[model samples]
Target: MITKYKLYFLTLVVSLLLLGCASKQNFIDKSKSITKETYTYHTFENKNKLQLDFYQSINYKNTKPLILYVHGGGFSGGARDENYIKNYCSKMAKNGFAVASISYRLTMKKLGFGCNTEASLKKEAFIKASEDISYATKYLIDNKKKFNIDTTKIILVGSSAGAEAILNLAYVYENKILAKEFKYAGVIAMAGAITSIEKISTKRAIPTLLFHGTKDKLVPYNVAPHHYCKKNKKGYLQLYGSKAIANKLKELNTSYNLYTIQNGNHSWNSKPMFVYFREMISFIDHQVLQSKYQQKEVVKKISDYTSTDL
Candidate 1:
């Protein structure tokens, strides 16, 4: 009952399926060399354990810089196992850095404080996330020996809401007892903002690298509401975007590098992953790894500046 054409079609289908499976397997196998381990960084009162996934390169001999990557989900729903996060972390590991993707407490549904304004609610969400980041940092520091982490070269890398949290952790909370314990080498904020520029100070300044799309609607490229709503709008808080932060750093005579994607939307990572990665690695090399902190006045617009110029 089998015609030649039917048999040929069936054979082709099977071949395609086999090829697809082989490609998938190959992809998985390629990343298998990067060892992954999970650890409980925090335990909430409800017995929920916050965990982080750390990726380490097997071939690297000496201790490596630690990069704590925070996923962005608008403060609601992202995970350490997200494909993008995993892939980014894996690439970072291969580049001779120990990378960790973390799961922090989210505040998407409701504000922690009852009967609070939109701005206050947003602030509370950021504060909660920052607290989690702090705890995760402490956990890593405590287990630095086990993870072979170079405490002197620790960097916080975050995207969107996660970026907001790390910015707060690095600047706003710097005076706090918990934050003072650790001296971070640098911070990478992708499409992130802060509630106020007052959080940034000369004494607590650290070299920062920022990547933001000019037309980002969710988080402003310049400055806008927390979710890009109008000022004083209900359920939305005003925020200072990367541009503002860079300007503040410039005013304080601190070191910072800003990358702007002209006419690009919020998903700059999708198309420019390699570009951002190269710039970030270069920043780490010069600003953090090489210990270069030239606090020159940032004259031109950040978009006009190149990585080499920084």
Candidate 2:
């Protein structure tokens, strides 16, 4: 009972609807296993809130590893969602590791010095941000069962100023000497500083991976032209190469790697980032941390990991 033109229009409308549904279904399929749930831990109701976005593993896990991300914005100018880490988190989650993009109290809020400390209140800022990171860790630790996490296998991954937080956490979490409640599997730093390496005298060896661009304009590859060799073996890698850092690690009898990207940009999400990520995953998958007391347990295992050392 319909005209030919009317019937044709109805058919086209149905085709368009089918296409729309298909497009949505494709997105669901791609991001299906990758969780993008934003868990609000604290609601400040318009003020600063401590939040966490969880990325879930799709396959290959009865239990999962967690990689917690601390975004870089120098402790004041960024959020957990800043710099679009969700994309990277999605990739990692899809690859079967649980990912968390975390929000910490901006240094200003912690210090109650918001817009007041104009002259770069760095020392205090680092302390406050570090505290925020620990709180996030405590949150995870307390909810380990709910999150279905391996409490023993948490990795603190931070960038830029957030690196300050990671280093501080590593130092404190050792010895349970500082009201320690959480334990970490490893730590990863992207453009992070090895602050207070001198204070690190504990035998609790945590595996560390440092990634930095050689041509970085900010957070220079070398701390100071004069202060390179004497203090930082990592810095010397920029001028010399990976072999220099590896040799230093061999000399110190520590486990680490420094990958210096030639002509890499400071903020660009380039090849260096993925290379860094891959190295970290390999380290985690290999489970490089054996307690100082567990030598007998992993002595044979270490020999098996010839690709990493030998």
Candidate 3:
């Protein structure tokens, strides 16, 4: 009992919905085809072990980019094989990239990571984590030919404490542990910061994608003390977070993207992997793999954000 034009409009809407569903189903099928391989990459002098969970597509080609991911646990406790991380890595793999999620030493596991924890200990934690990442990178580079991956396209992705480690290594700290000529292709830091913002110079400026919440209580969106500790506290260490780092990169005229979440909390550490996957992939393709100079800042309020949408 409908007019011809009204029926035509209805048919078009139904076709569009079906097309969307078909596309989503295709993505799911591709995601299911990812393969994961585990490797014991390093062993400490104390006989402690570390491992890497390498994820790739079943039909992965040669010279594909690699994403090295570090999990967040405040230098206390976090596993590389967590379900969320696995899912995230799987998605990246489905996109024709190799992903390596690594395990590092939890130096602060025994001594809690709190205001009572000394700043020196916090610094040591960052150094230790970065060292582990360096070793992991070296292992991948050494076997790049075997894995058929392009070592030059290796990007670092981390959350919270892990983000701090990667950012610190990318800028503030020198990698005396790795080969002198080696450098990470880019960095994706989620709620991350660095110990010294001044250390990030033109030479160290790489393609960077920063995701941070303005209301992040642990890591500051700008310059602030670690864990918001007071000046007299033992763990009072100043950190330059995402906003500060992005501003530095802007001053240096480097390629960077800062996605600021207004009133968003530290939970954004994992949300980007799920919600902003396209942005991450775009950065890898345009900024890291190619020479794309984009200094973009996206600010979204919490009320406007939902898990289902990009």
TM-scores for all candidates?
Answer: 0.81, 0.66, 0.90
Candidate 3 residues 118-224, lDDT tens each? 99999999999988999899999899987778887789999998899999889977787788988889999999998998888998899999999999999999999
TM-score of 3: 0.90
Ranked by lDDT from best down, the candidates are 3, 1, 2
Candidate 2 lDDT over residue span 231-307, tens digit each: 33322211222223333344556666566555654552223334344455556554443322111101112223233
Tens digits of lDDT, candidate 1, 185-263? 8998988888888868887789998878888877887877755665555656777888899889988978898777776
Q: In model 3, what are the clashing residue pairs, if there are any? A: none
- Scanning candidate 2 in windows of ten residues, the lowest lDDT window is 293-302
Worst 10 residues of 3 by lDDT: 16-25
Which candidate would rank higher by lDDT, 1 or 2?
Answer: 1
| Candidate 3 segments whose C-alpha is farther than 4 A from its true place | 1-30, 307-310
Ranking by TM-score: 3, 1, 2
Per-prediction CA RMSD (Å): 12.9, 14.6, 8.4
In Å, residue 38's CA in model 2 sits off its true spot by 2.2
